[model samples]
Target: MLENWHDVNGLIGNSLIYFDRNDQQWHQSWIDTNGSSLALAGGFIGGVLTLSGTKPNTGELHEIQWRPLKLGRVEQIWRMSLDNGATWTPRFRGIYYAVDQQN
Candidate 1:
């Protein structure tokens, strides 16, 4: 999957999600206009797609989850743990809806 968007401050961001059959896991790479980037790897857990990893430069642990909702919508949550996963703080949360193609 591919995604591109800009925040209210006009910070362009892009991400790619793919499945690596060799490891049987899903991976995602994200980068933003601020030159920040992140890489995470994991698979579905309890029906939710959760991926997590640490930032190579900052060592900050990050996790992102995508949950399915009704009417083909989805909820995405991004979290961060500065204390080695001992405590988590929500960084971003957004709901996504499928675009109507027949428009």
Candidate 2:
């Protein structure tokens, strides 16, 4: 579930992958408590992703990175850092699978 700084419920839709002309970085757009924004950026290599943004209400900073896999299924090893990428804490590992059928 998604929530705002005030703890109000929010929503997120399908991810949009695009290249930001301003920053010259690849990013995925999503809607969160902070409205629609770039939630993830294509990192250095090996499917590494990074996220750094400020909270809407409290102005708190957030930083996270992960390496994702998506050949047959979706999986990621996500990590979070509070001190400007100085250190990271393994929070959770997630995976999802889906199939398509035609009648």
Each prediction's whole-model lDDT (CA): 0.94, 0.54
Q: Specify the poorest-scoring 10-residue window by lDDT in model 2.
A: 1-10
Residue 53 deviation, candidate 1, in Å?
Answer: 1.1
lDDT of 1 by residue, 36-89 (tens): 999999999998999999987898999999999999999999999999999999
**Cα error, candidate 1, residue 63 (Å):** 0.5
Question: Best candidate per TM-score, number?
Answer: 1
Task: lDDT for model 1, please.
Answer: 0.94
Predicted structure 1, TM vs. truth: 0.90
Model 1 is weakest, by summed lDDT over 10 consecutive residues, at 1-10
Clashing pairs in 2: none
Cα error, candidate 2, residue 46 (Å): 3.0
